[model samples]
Each structure stands twice: as structure tokens, then as C-alpha cells.
Target: MPLALYLLALAVFAMGTSEFMLAGLVPDIASDLDVSVGTAGALTSAYAIGMIVGAPLVAAFARNWPTRTSLLSFILAFAAAHAVGALTPDFPVLFATRVVAALANAGFLAVTLTTAATLVSPDRKGRALAVLLSGTTTATVAGVPGGAVFGTLFGWRATFWTVAALCLPAALGVLKGISAGLVQEHAADGPASHTELATDGPALRTELAQLARPRLILVMLLGALVNAATFAGFTFLAPVVTDAAGLGELWVPVALVLFGVGAFTGVTVAGRLSDRHPGPVIAVAGPLLLIGWPALALLAAEPVALLTLVFVQGALSFALGSTLITRVLYEAAGAPTMAGSYATTALNMGAAVGPLLAATTLGTAAGTLGPLWSSGLLIAAALLIALPLRTTISTGRGIEVPR
Candidate 1:
């Protein structure tokens, strides 16, 4: 692996940490701002909205800029946003800063992916993408947990401040290291580059156009459904454990940590498994979804059953998640960055939908089990969608031909 890959991973790690740490620190922020949890929840949702919007916009508009310049600008922008977030005294100001930070976050990810594709040989692109994505997975394991701990010890504002400090080191690494050539291609034709892929372009176009195909549409549809399934129950985890499982407030952070652990393991395993035997890896994630539903239900009914089932549900359901993105990249050969942005945007849309569904479901149900029940059923539905694709999808290997 190139040293640049490691630097890219560090950048992703810092970004992921900054994004996810908000979940654990929402209460602190809410308390400090004298706002409701629902309002503070918007802070998370706002970031997702920013990511969805910024991904394509930046990719399209900033396509002509140098990679180093683009990345450095994004990092500096992200640092500024976080600095504002750390210092803001009012909720509205903080919300605006979160939106800016999210824009930086999305742009950073899109560029990182496009750069990774250019950094390695064609055949090794999957692995290259995985190396960069590891930062996201690793964040679940370490960054989020560490941020949560920091928030507990210091305050929510302190977490953002810490992230800003971390950003400086990440920025320095990228500034000093990335080659100018690495990012130049992303802007190659800007909008005109479609002609470059002619002959091969149609195949790539068809792959991206698959976003509209029924089966492909099914996959995209499930992206939102799957996340909704997780978030519906997850968003209200605190209330559920407290009310239904008879757990204390302390269990909330503990549960999140467990969720993080499961997700961390899932992403790492999925990356490796997808490379070796993607078919079976994706196949297994389907049944894992079904199993997780019952596990969550059982755990909800008997809180003592927490550790085993919750962890299982968290890990198994998400195992094949990012692998699906890899599959999309496989299909979208020439326009990998746009395809990546599409995949990510779809997931973000799903994330947004999931929370809305939870708000509605949890509002009506007598207890926390309502959202949990809803999330489980949706996950099972996602399983049905994923199972058939595994049998039909065929991704061929390739050697790097002249561009």
C-alpha cells in the first residue's frame, strides 16, 4: 500500500469521528443550548442533508480544480465549520455551522474516493477504496467512543474543539503528501469527459443508469429501508431501554458503544470478505438481518439479553452495507466518483427517511417496542431484496487498459 493511502485513511477517520460523535453528544448540546432533543436531533439530520446535497454539487462544480487544492480547501472549510460549532453560543448559529461542516464532510469523502481510484491499479481499486473506507469503520470503533468519553469528561463543545485540533494534523498530512496528479482526473472533462468513455462509456453509463433499473432500483430502495430499519429502533434506544428493558440512563452510551463495536467489526469483515467471496458475504448479511430483528426484540423483552443479541444484530445487519457500495463501484467503472456519490446519497436519503419513520412510529406506540418492531420488519424486508441480487449480480475482474 502507498503511504498516501494511510494519510487518506487518517483524514477519513477524523471526518467520521467528527460526524458521528454528535450522536453521543446530542444530549450535552441540547442541554447546553436549552433545546429539546428533537431539535438537537436536527443537527444530525442537517449534516445528512448537507452530505446529500454537497456530494454531487461539489463533484460537478469542483471537477476542474486540482485534487490537492480541492482537498485542502475542504479540510480547511471543515476545520472552520467545526471551530464555529465549538464556539457558537446559540442554537441557530450552531445549526448553521453543522450544515457547513457537513458540506465539507461530503466533499471530502467524494474526493477521497475519486482520488483512491486514481491512486491504484484498476484491479486493485476495490482494495484501495476499502483502505480509505477503513477510516469510517475505524471511527465507529475508536473515534466515536473516544469522543463520547471526551464529551462525558469535558462537555459537548469540548468534543468539537478536540475534532478541530485533530483536523489540523489531518490537514497537514494531506497538504504535505498528496500528489497533484492524484486529484487532477476527477475534473478531467468536468461535464465533457463523457466522450472519453465512449464505447466503454455506454457500459459505464448503463451501470450508473442502473440507478433507474428495477433490480438496481430495488437495491437503492432498500438502502433507505435498511437504514430506516436500524434507525427507527436505534433513534429511540434510550427511551426503549429505560422504559421497556428497565435499564438506566448509563446503558444508553453503553448500547451505542456496543453498536459501534458491532459496526466496526462488520465493516472490516465485509471489506475483506467482499474481496475474497463477495457473493457469500452479501448472502450471509441477508439472513443476518432476519436474525437481528428477533435478537433486538428478544433483547428488548429481556434487557439482560442485551450484550449477545444487540451486538449480533448490530454487526450482522451492517456487515454487507459498505460492500454493497463496492459492488456499485464495480459496476460504475469509468465514473466511480459519481457512482460513489450516488450510492452515498441514496444511503443518506435512507438515513433521513429512517428517522422520520421512527418519529412517526414511536409517537403512536405505547412503548419503545413500536419503533423496534417497525425497524425489525423493515430489515426483514431488506433481506428479501438483497437475497435475489446475490444470485444474479456478476462482477468481472479486469486489467488496467490505456485510458
Candidate 2:
């Protein structure tokens, strides 16, 4: 891949951390802001809702603007929102900032994914996506846990400030690294059909229309199911390790790190092979996760089994998740510049839905392990969704995937 891709990934790490970093800081925020903990927790939901709704809207709005112009604008907005969030006193003001930050994150991330596709040759799109997603996985390991620690040492505001600070360089790097021709949709080599609509400044309806493809819908649905499996289990991982497994507080981060490390491995491996072998990757990981989550539900009390399964499931979940996101990009090949927004929507839809399902399961008989059972059911659903694809893509080599 290119240096631009790495720069984008760096920016993504910061944004991804904020998506869940607030989970650790909720109590402090509730105390400082003089609100109940439940109210403070709504900020994360605000971010998730913004991500789901803003992606397509922002993509369509910026569809007419120069790519570099839009990208830089979103990056600056993200940084400024965080800065404002850090400095804000009123809870409502901070809530607004979170929404703005998420909108900015959505826009910039959508553009970056399509930008990555435009930067690489067709055979390497999977690798490019892997590189991008690895940033998110890394955030799960380092950025989030580290942010929690940082907030504990300093204050939650300091973590917000740090994210804001990181965005400045990322914006500058993206400004320098992006091709001028790319921003103008005049690539030197060939048609830019995949990057933009056939006409200049296409209407929002036109961009939205691209999402109507049957195959694209199925691919995106599959993506959502995969993510639902991940987030449903992960949103409660700390509690699962501590409350259910009877591990100490120290083991929470260890479990998260194990999962995050496995995710790194999964994304790395998927990037190298997904373009040519997505079918096999999905086929293997899907079944393993179906078995793994239930086994986790049954064996959480066993420290050795619990830790080992967390690592293994993390790897398998991300491996399949990476492949599915890549598939969404390819399946939406006709989406012009809107393909990345489609990917974002599918990705965050799971982020929103998974937790809702898991939260409901919490008060039931399953308690902490309810999320694991939910995750297992999601995996089964995902496998069922892919069942039809098996016949169509019997050999992994046949799909016309990303570059």
C-alpha cells in the first residue's frame, strides 16, 4: 500500500478509540457533569447513531466537493469537535460535539476507504482494507485501554485533547499525500467509475440509488451480522472476564489485549489472501466462531479455556469481518464514490444493533454470558446468510473483488 493509507489508518486509530473509550470514563463523566451514569453512557450511543446516519448524508453532501477539500474539512471538523468536547462544560454541548465528531469521522472514513481503493491496483484492495482495519484493531488493544489508563492518571478531558492533537498531523499528512488528480476525479491511468458518479456532482438520490443492488444489500447484511457478533460479545468483555470468570480487575485489560492482538493477526492474514480466497476464509472462520462462542458460554469459569477462547474468537471474528467488509466494497463496485459509505453503514449498524441485543440479554438468566450466547446466535445467522453464497462461490478464486 501507500504512505497515504498508513496516514489514514493512523487517524482511524484515534477515532476508533473514542468510539468505546467513553465506556471506561462514563463514571467520571457522570460525576463531573453531575448526571446519572445512564445519561452519561448515552454519549457513546450518540456517536454510534451519528456514524450510522451521517455516513450516507455526508458522503452525498461531499460528493460534489473536491475529494481533498472534503477530506481535509472532515478531518479538521473531527479534531475541532474533540477539542471542543475536551473544553466544554455543559453536558449538552459535549453531546453535540460527540455527534459532530462522529459525523466527521463517518465522512472522512468513507472517503478514506474509497480513496484507498482508488490508490491501489485491483488485486491489492483487500490488503489496503486490511491495513485500514488493522488501525481499528490496534485501537482495541492499545488506544482504548491506554486511553482508559491515561484518563485515570490525568482526566477524561486529557484523553479527548490527545485525540484532538493527533488529528492535526493526520490532516496535514492526508493533505500532502493525496493525489491532486484523485481529488479532481481525473486519475492519470483510467476511468474513475468506481470513485465517482458518471456525471459531475451527482444528486443525493443518485448516490442513494446505488445501494439498490440485490447483491450489494446481501453483502452489506452479511457485514452487519458479522459485526453484530463481534460487538455484542465485546461490549461486555470486561464484565465477562471479571464478573463471570471471577478474574481480578487486572485481567480485564489482559483479555482485551489478547482479543485485540488476535484481531491484528486476523486482519493481517485476511489482507494477504481475501482478494483471492475470501470464500475459504469465511467458510473456515464462520464455523469455528459458531462453535467457539457457545464453548465460551459453557466454559467462562475456567480461566485457561476462557483466555484461550477469547484470543481464538477474536482472530476468527476479525478475519471474517475483514473479508465481509472487503466484500461490501467489491459488491458495491457500481456505487461510484458511495461504496465506502455503504461499508460504513453496514459496519456501524452492527455496532448499534449488537449492543442493544446484548443489553437486553443482561437482565435475563444468562447474565454476563448472555452476550456470548447472543454472539453465537449471530454467528449462526451469519453462516446462514452465507449459505447461498457457497454455491455461487464454490472456489474462492472466482469472485471479482477489490484491487
Candidate 3:
């Protein structure tokens, strides 16, 4: 691994911490802003919306920029947004900062995906993605709980400052990466610069047309459904631990840490298997999530049961989620320039939509338990939707190279 890879991972850790930490901070933000919890929860969706919009737009333009320059620009923009977020007292201003931070994060993530893949041999693409995404998984383990703890000790604003400060070190690392001569310009026409196995070009029309393929659309929807299930349940977990399970505020970070630990483990295992055994991994985890999500809903009131199920569900969620994302890359083998953005958009769209649906369940008879039930339904829908997309995943090695 290059020093640049580790630097890129740091970039992900900084942004991902902010993204997942909102789950724990929503209650704090709501209380501080004098808004309903559901209303404050919209911050997560705002971030997701930014990511969804940023993916395609930035991808379209940044596709031709130097790899180092693009990464540096996005990282600096992200830091600036988080700085604004940390200082803002107004809810709307804070909300706007989250969206801006997400847009910068989205552009960085999309470009990183393609950039990381090119660092490895063709057969190791899955592992490259996994390595890049590991930053996200690691952020879940450390940064999410750390953010929650910071929010508890100081304020939600303190956590934003912490994330912004992280970017300083990451920015320095990116400069060092440039000095190492590791990441050069990404020239679509100069050489075989893109990830696709087939011939690639700089044609914008060729890239846009791939977004319309019926098969690609199905895969994107499948990714969206899985994320919908994840965020729907995950966005409300602080409440589930405290309000539903009758735990103290202290337990919130503990609960998040357990889920984070599980996610870290899940993504690590999925990374190794996704390259050669994606079909089997997906086949097994999908059914398990179906059963596990509902079980979490039924046992939401039992502290031990809820905690145990949170770990299990986190593991299942990311393991399956990572595989599906890798599948998107495979299915998008023809859309070299657009593939990363497409994958980013698919997952972010689900992230944007899920919490909105979960917000509807907050005050119902289901109470705090509604989020998990919604998640369960989303998983069922995801499985049904994957039927068509799964046909393309091979049972053998190379995860069935796209024809």
C-alpha cells in the first residue's frame, strides 16, 4: 500500500465520522434548537442529499482533473464546511453546513473509488474498494463513538470541530502523497486510465448513456434499498437505546460502539470474500438480515437483547452493503468514467430517502420501535428487488466479469 492510500483512508475517516455521528447527535441538536427530534433528524438526510447531488455533478467535471488536485480541493472544502458547522448556532445554518460538507465528501469519495482501483491489478479491484471503504468501517469503530462522546462532553458543535481538525493532518498527507509521485493525472485518452475492462473514452455522452441501462438501474436500486434499510434503523438508534430500552444517556455511546465494532468486523471479512466469493456472501447475509431485523424490533425493549441484536445487525448490514456496492462496480464495467458516481449516487439516494421514511414512524404506536420495523420492510423489499440483479453475479471467481 502507498502512503497515499493511508492518506486517502484518513480523508474517509474524517468525513465518515461526521456522517454516522449525526445519529447520536440528532437528539442533542433537537433539544438545543427547540425542534422536534424528527425535524432535527433531517440533518442526516440533508447530508445524504448533498452526496446524491454531488456525485454526478462533480464526477462529470472532476473526471478530467489531476488526481491529487481533485482530492485536495474536496478535502479543503470539507474542512471549511465543517468549520462553519462548528460555529453555527442557527439550525438552518447548521443544516446548510452539513449539506455542504457532504457535497465535498461526496466528490472526494467518488473520485477516490476510481483512483484507488487503478492502484491495483485488475483482479484485485474488489480489495482496492474494500481497502478504500475500510476507512469508513474504521471510522464507524472509532470516530462514531468518539463523536458521540465529544458531543456528550462538550456539545454537538465540538464534534464538528473535531472532524474539521482531522482534515488538517489528512491534507498534509495528500501533499506528501503528491511529492511521492504516486498519484498522477487521470488521463482518459492518454492510456488505459479507467477501471473498465473494455475500451474507455472521454465522451460525456458515452458515460451518461450507461446511467440509463435497465440492468445498471436495477443494481443501483438494490444498493439504494439496502441503504434505506440501514439508515432507517440506524439513524434512530440513540433513541432506541435510551428511550426504548430505558437506558441512561451514558449507554448511547456504548451501544454505538458495539455496532461499530461489528461493522468493522463485517467489512473486513466482506473485503476478503467479495473478490472471489461475492455470490455466496450475499446469498447468505441477505436472508439473515431479513430474519434479524424483525427480531431487533421485537426485542427493542430488552436491553441485552437490543444490544446483542445491534451488533448482529450492524455486521449483516455492512457485509451485505459492501458486496452490493462491489456488484455495482462489476455491473458498471462499461461505464468507466461514470461508475463510481453511479455507485455513490445509488447508496446516497437510499441514505437520503430512508430517514425520511423512518421519520414518519417516530410518534406512531410503534414508538421508538418503528425504525427497526421499517428497516425490516426495506430489507424484504431489497431482497425482492435484487432478484433481477443477482442473476448477473457469477457463482464462480472474478464475481462474473461483466460480459
Please report the candidate that would top TM-score against the real structure: 2
Identify the candidate with maximal lDDT: 2
lDDT of 3 by residue, 1-403 (tens): 5567778888899988988888778899999878899899888778878899999898888776666777889999999998987787788998888888888998988877766655655555566677677788778889988787789999998888889999988888877765322333333323223333323354778778877877678778888888889888887888999888999988887777788778777777887888778888788989999999889988888999999999998898888888778777767766665688888998888887887799799889998889899999999998887766575753344422232
Better of 2 and 3 by TM-score: 2
Per-candidate local distance difference test:
0.69, 0.85, 0.80
lDDT tens readout by residue for model 2, 1-403: 6687898898999899888799889999899899999999999999999999998889878876667788889989999999999998889999999999999999988888887776676656788899999889999999989999999999999999999888888888778987544542323334433344334544567657767876778778888998999999999998889988999999999999899999999999988888778888888988999999999989999989999999999999999988888877877666657889999999999999998999899999999999999999998998887797764432353233222
Clashes of each: 3, 4, 0
Which ranges of candidate 2 are over 4 A from the true structure? 181-206, 392-403
TM-score of each candidate structure, all chains considered together: 0.84, 0.93, 0.87
Residues 229-281, candidate 1: write the lDDT tens digits.
Answer: 76676667777667777888887767766776787677667666664466776
Better of 2 and 3 by lDDT: 2
Query: Model 3, which residues run further than 4 Å from truth?
Result: 24-42, 88-93, 178-200, 394-403
